[model samples]
Target: MDYYKVNSKNLSLLKERVSVPTYDRTNVKAGILHIGIGGFHRAHEAFYTDELLNKNSNSNWGICGVALLSFDQRIYQTLKDQNGLYTLIVKELDGTLTKTIIGSIVDYLFAPENPIAVIERIANPEIKIITLTITEGGYNYNEATGEFEIENPSIQKDLKNPNDPKTVFGYLTQGLKLRKENNVSGCTIQSCDNIQGNGHVTKKMLLSYVKHAEPELVSWIESHVSFPNSMVDRITPATVSADMAALKETSGIEDAWPVVCEPFKQWVIEDDFIAGRPAWEKVGAQFVEDVVPYEKMKLSLLNAGHSVLGILGTLIGYSTIDEVVNDTVVSAFLEAYMEQEVIPTLGDLEGVDLNEYKKSLLQRFGNIYIKDQVDRICSESSAKIPKFMLPTVQSQLKDGGSIELAAFVIASWAIYSLGVDENGTKIPIKDAVKAVLHEKAVAAKSNPKAFLDIESIFGSLADSESFVEVFTKSYQNIMQFGVKKCLIDLNSKF
Candidate 1:
């Protein structure tokens, strides 16, 4: 197979190999500016927009992708080189792969190279929606305090250079300022991360960041901007070299970076666009007045499911999520955890069937072809625990229900941070609070309460005696019997 790079020029030759963009490249205008072009953004947000373009829904709604961090430039350069075209290799549970060429992104800019270009892009009145998938950590938020880290050094620098700023919040305020000065309409800001009440948090943080950095812009921002809460779900594994290699070998299209996700994709967004939005619902997106029910369903069930087993997968030396979920004991443990703990906390959703959703998630997690890394899922459990896991504990405790699995997840997170797995192999841990977590993990070896006392990670759970008792017991069980045996023990007990 000849190595035909995916681009507008190679569209004809690679048409059968991968789905090509039907809309004329030149006619597509930039109407949406997406922050952080990562695997999830490409797989979920960009995929949906690509489908909308396929239906010829709106030409002005094309995406302008932006990269903020230094590492982001590497993968995004491929999109730029190929004229904003990339491949979506969707994986099925039974080893089927669907190759798609996504062209929703008409243009891309690395903000680190030139911030003004991105600023101008945001200031444009035609750009109505500014969506972000910068991840939970990228928000620069403290989950415990619900506060923006205003004291961050980068933010401090951005505070000094408000007009030519560095952070996302800086660009938001500065661009909105320019828009106001130019008498243009305000744009909607959509957050598509795993956080609960994502849009509400975005608005709160943006307002808080600017209140001190650019005080004058606060009221105008409050009146003009709209941050609609949204819930986006897709099991997009971080693209690896092998995925790219397979894509090229199979499709004869050499994509520098291609996203591989499970075939399941969903987006439930609040209908609160400030200016206007694309007809995404035409392509199966759900728009509701309140996205809380949907948000709870995803965060508690799907995300919490990943959270509960992610560290156990890492600790037991399972490389990918498929292998973890494939284990009969681990699968049974997850099934019991969801049924007895996580599901009891969720309210009845109007359109969604919770039981069916859980069944689908098990299949999604067990999709071997997708190769979702356990370390990737386990990575930042300190931050993730607050969003995906802690809420379940809070809700379960409120109802006076079982919290054994929730406690076990937290226990696994603490022990996993010790930088060594059960086999005594060194594990590289990544987190926003790794230093604090490491010290706590070490301290917890002698006293389990030491780890639970990390108020930022556990919040009020640290203050609960019953919660602490269960968590302490779970941690001790893992220490004595190892994660594998304890998992079996938990499955049988639950």
Candidate 2:
């Protein structure tokens, strides 16, 4: 129970006392190589792997985590200091909490110090799956084409010298080359990013690297590698002092690397793996033939809904999803937005009731205990917009439908680009177009096209007259009337 010490006894006590699920951690082999070792990956995929290990005594699905970015050294040291152990706290709406010690991670590799070593391990015949949580931006994609940016400096270096490239794609291609050279069959590359058709996107990126870097390897990867699309849902907020205090009170263990997430967790994976997979379904994972419809539903409705709350939440001076969801106006706006704008664009899918899904989404957003930060949800709007909002906008416009809500969301994004929140406090905007956006905002006065004109983010959609008119009108309204008033006007349209 000592705060400063972490040993097996304390870990076991914390798990037992907190009602954390303990897994049979011995028999699982290191088959999966995870690229990102961040909070969500630990709370979601790692948690799932832990459950699988607990159920199946002899599972072969342990994960070896690889950190590509420079900041990973601290994470590497933290996990290594604790002997590859960390606690995940799942907080519920009514103040209920459950803490679990995740042990599915068997090894760790820092890219800068041990890139080749990591690549070699990835090529191992026993390693049958390479999964990634490398975020939407980490793929080094060309914003205009949504393909892997081949001219990326890291990628260029990798192509010039396959033995050493700092990028994830570079490491992956190198590993695949090793696999081919050693006659070891290729592994399934499962992309867990929030992008729609994540697997296909990952394939395109990887194959793009292969085409120039290793053409022979490209053919083998095309034929052998299985890139399965997956929909991963979990609301994990950035850690705060309150979370640390809660962990201290509950676990009596001071965890420097503790992760706090909502009690709700969902993983819908396509049942496609080249070298086979674990019985993850036993651990409450949904396995289906095609994950596109489900992915679209979740991405457009749930994720996009979160974006709506995030931007508007910050603008309204709310700190968390729970806070924003409780505001009557915000809550009603989201409900109307989803029902009118998002749902109509979605095609029906088997085993999914759209109405029920919307209801559940509202409930999840209202779970006050989750404390999901608006800044966290709103950070990567540039990457997220295309996936979560654009498809719906395009569909609605093509059908000559009203896009009041969607347009408002775009206007909010432009407002966000102004670099100030409701209280006149500056909110840090992180995007590839941050500098240009700030300049444009200075000149254009919260004009939506100012941000959209960054052709990389919107592609040719920026030039569409219908989109321009709708978005421009919405932006002008928001600038004149503000978010709350704009919401009132949007509702009047219904």
Best by TM-score: 1
Local lDDT at 145 for model 1: 86
Candidate 2 per-residue C-alpha lDDT over 85-171 given as tens digits, one digit per residue, 9 for 90 to 100: 788888876888877778888778888897789889889998999999988887778667886777777777877877777888889
Worst 10 residues of 1 by lDDT: 452-461
Model 2 TM-score, 2 decimals = 0.95
290 in model 2: Cα distance from truth in Å? 0.7
Which lDDT values do the candidates have, in the order given?
A: 0.87, 0.82
Clashes of 1: 0
Decoy 1 TM-score against native: 0.98
At residue 371, give the lDDT of candidate 1.
Answer: 81
What are the RMSD figures for all models against the true structure? Answer: 1.1, 1.9
Q: Between which residue pairs do clashes occur in model 1?
A: none
Q: In model 2, which runs have C-alpha deviations exceeding 4 angstroms?
A: 1-4, 7-9, 12-16, 19-27, 446-448
TM-scores for every predicted model: 0.98, 0.95
